[model samples]
Target: MRGELSLVADCKVVRFDAAFDITRETIGAISDVTLARRDAVTAMRRAFAELNGADVPIICLLRNTSENGLRDAKNLGATCCLSAHTPPAMVARTMMTQVIQDRADRPVRSIERGVARATEVLTRLFDGARSNGPVALAQVDASLEPIIEAVRDGGLTRWLDRVWTHDDATYQHCLLVAGVAAKFSLHLGFSASDRNHFVRAALLHDLGKARIPLAILNKPGRLDEGEMTVMRTHPVIGYEKLKAAGCDALTLGAVRHHHEMLDGSGYPDRLSGDSIGDTVRLMTICDIYSALTEKRAYKPAMPNAVAMAILSDMKGRLEDRLVQSFGEAMGNGS
Candidate 1:
């Protein structure tokens, strides 16, 4: 059986007479397993216990096994079960399919974990804001690493695709911005410190929105003038809260001025070009791009090309050179 499997597969196949011979390390090292025995159900149970939480696929080939035995094997973690007479080629195909599927699912699982971690951090921070509890900068900083790593592994397109489906609009936008900022920083070859600061700023930029009334924050349509005025106060709200929590200068600046414009046309503070620091400038571009690309109840998500075009059109409002760099970072090119 081992020789047949080796002939069908392109990789080395190890044979073990007893299930006890398969160690956790061996399970981790192998792609898949083929367990053939008269007592296949018991063998499968033992194999699954050894697997613990590892995701290796297992195929059980049972001789004279009853339907109940096959069902028991499946319940015990067998990925597939077949009669012992089944051809080796068929088993090889099943193994290949499972391997391919596991590979494809890895990125998605990583993204899910990243988003979940970010959500936990954001929720704690936002809850702290509402209750005036102590805010932990360390926790917030740690949260960015998962997201940064996820973007690095999955690419910006895949990150965006997953984050766009997040349920909470506010959380979704923050996650989107942080992911884009991480990707942008990588593209520019920013140092580790700078990249960390960039993603940290993106994650906390909208922390002020936690104080905004939910009715206004989640409004389905355009805000009236009065609502718009209240809605625009998020940057200052976030800035002051984070400042009190002992955040650094770059974080405070981005939290306060991510909405500020280079042409002094933006709200909260109308500080023009030179007054707006580089952190805020880079953050503003990421912020706007995230907002435009994010799907909202009132509007469908904008296409990446259209959003880039909009940025290009804001020649006087956003830093022109930075905008070009941002275009390049997003793979839109100069």
Candidate 2:
């Protein structure tokens, strides 16, 4: 039966008689499960108990499709209960459709959890900064781990799609930058430690914005020259706050210079090429992409192609190589 199903669908079919055969890897790899056993309900209960909170669709192929038996199966997480005599082709087709639908629906099911956790942590962190309390770097790491894992499991496109819906402009942009930076670091195959540094910098890059007045920070229109000056001070403001909190120099540099351009055209500090380190350069790319693609009250969200084109046009200001790499990293080719 497993061999017949495998031939019909492009999926790995694992056969198990009982719940004892399940493992963590099994849970991670499976999109759908088939229970072809005499004690189907008993097996499903044990299987789901071992699965913990992992969400995988289950199909039951039982000898008896009695109403009570089907009810028990449905209550135990089975999506469909069919007689054991069902054809392999029909079962395979049903399983394939379920797998495809599951992937399509994953963003809605998975990303919300990660986004909520990240938002809770950011709210606490920004509020702490506003109150002049010590920044808890450990807590920030704990919060972002779920987000990173979500992006890894669900893909960057889905993560961005959900993040763009957030109502708070400041928190939305921070989350966007963090998600993009996490994906970028993973795309570039950065070491775990280095990736953590990039993500941490992205998350806290706008820490100083907490101090900015609501009128200016949440302005419905573009900032005028005076307001622009205040906005540009955020990098330095963030740098000072994080520095005082004992942040390492690498993170401090990225936080302070994420806006700095390769040609000394950026704000707070006009440090030119080579003077800008790789960490700052990468963070700048993620920051710009997130900002441009984000929808705002005053300006509509720029399309990804348009944003990438603008980055490409900045021949002198941004690092051309990194810009191209960032486009590829975002699944939008340079």
lDDT per residue as tens, model 2, 100-217? 7766776666678778878888898788888988877668877666777777777777788788888888999999998899899888998887887788889999998988887898
> Which residue pairs in model 2 clash with each other?
none
**Model 1 ranges with Cα > 4 A deviation:** 1-27, 30-100, 332-334
TM-score of each: 0.73, 0.73
Q: Write the per-residue lDDT of candidate 1 for residues 190-283, one digit (tens) a residue.
A: 9988999999999999998988999998888789999999999998988898988899998899999998898899878899979999999999
After superposition, the stretches of candidate 2 with alpha carbons farther than 4 Å from their true spots are: 1-22, 28-50, 53-104, 332-334
Clashes of 1: 0
Sequence-dependent TM-score of model 2: 0.73
Best by lDDT: 1
CA lDDT, every model vs. true structure: 0.79, 0.77
